[model samples]
Target: MYRRSFALVAALAAVLVLVPAALAARVHVRVEGKTQTIFGSTEPTLNVKANALDALDAASLAGEFYYHVAPTAFGPYVDQIGRYPALPGSPNGWVFKVNGIVPPVGADQVTVKDGDTVLWYWATFTGAAGPLTLEVETSIVRGKRCFFATGRNDAGRASRVRGVVFTLNSRRVGSRSGVLCTRLGRYAVRVAKAGAIRSRTYSGR
Candidate 1:
């Protein structure tokens, strides 16, 4: 009896140790073209274990935003997030992708794993949304950390925009013509063009 009790307690302790690891999948989420009002994390990443819908719910609860999910034959469909609703007679709505690929499953069914990125953007299904992709490349030039940004359309074609500004922590640091200098702390870098392009934010170290 004493041996069985000791083994039971040891097994319970082992399960407790493993439960947190299983529940702590890191996932990055981005809601493009909207003001950053989600959980006050760095770039809206889910450091805890969560599915796609779970991440959205956590953000909505933390940010006090509204989101609706409708039951469909396939699964739960996202009807509206915040003030944006699916447009009638159009494919415009909240479309999402995991790891840069559009998944066939609904957000509720999509299980997010560690190091996976989930992007939710509000735009028409048509390719004219402008700057569907944005990336910041960092390198060391002349012993200084430099950042270069690029924007691309849905067709994977690059975009040419004038006066591309790089903002660090909401402050404009430099333009596209020049390399941006970095600071010690983590900075949220946003690059944008006027009118024809949508802005994208990336984390800079």
Candidate 2:
């Protein structure tokens, strides 16, 4: 009995030593809600603890937005964010993804590693499984400004986004040939479409 208790105590000591180091890790976070990008779109990279909810908590404190989490059967559920609430049969709600995947568990249950990207956005749901998301990438080469955009569903499946438009430095520009040759300089770029969550801003120099 004494040997078993000693082993248990050693295991607990190991866990206590590991947890604090993980909590200080850096995570890239983005909050998209309502009519515009709330945080991390044009802002700097965010710092978070070890879960998706921790990233949201950091954004809420830094951006000074209101959010509420409720204890549910599955786990902790984020029911309200900013001015939007996940109501019964209402379209206004929130959805989240870590590294482009909708995690099967709740945000608090999912453990996030360093450099993981956590994105939470307000979405209007149609049915049970709806509301697509967009991922954007930008690059500059030889004075040519280029963008690559893709749309992802709730399942993290990707497809090309149709009729993609870019907001570069607050100027709206449309792409016809899948590439824009705007003069390359330090700029911030965001992609949008007709019916998807707009992407987090990508800055290029």
Which numbered prediction scores highest in lDDT against the true structure?
Answer: 2
RMSD of each: 4.9, 6.4
lDDT of 2 at 99: 84
* Per-residue C-alpha lDDT of model 1 across residues 1-205, encoded as one tens digit per residue: 9999999999999999999767877777666534433333344666545678776766676567788888879888777887777856776677666665566678877888888876666655555443355556677666666777665564446544445677778797557563476645576776655432334466756
> Cα deviation of 90 in candidate 2 (Å)?
1.9
Clashes of 2: 0
lDDT of 1 at 113: 88
lDDT (Cα, 0-100) at 44 in candidate 2: 53
Full-model lDDT for every candidate: 0.64, 0.80
Cα deviation of 30, candidate 1, in Å: 3.0
lDDT of 2 by residue, 1-205 (tens): 9999999999999999888756665788889887888887854566677789988998998899889999888888899888878997777778789888888888998887777888898887677775778777667677687677888888889887767788888998887544555776888778887668898777767
In candidate 2, position 67 carries an lDDT of: 94
Highest TM-score: which candidate? 2
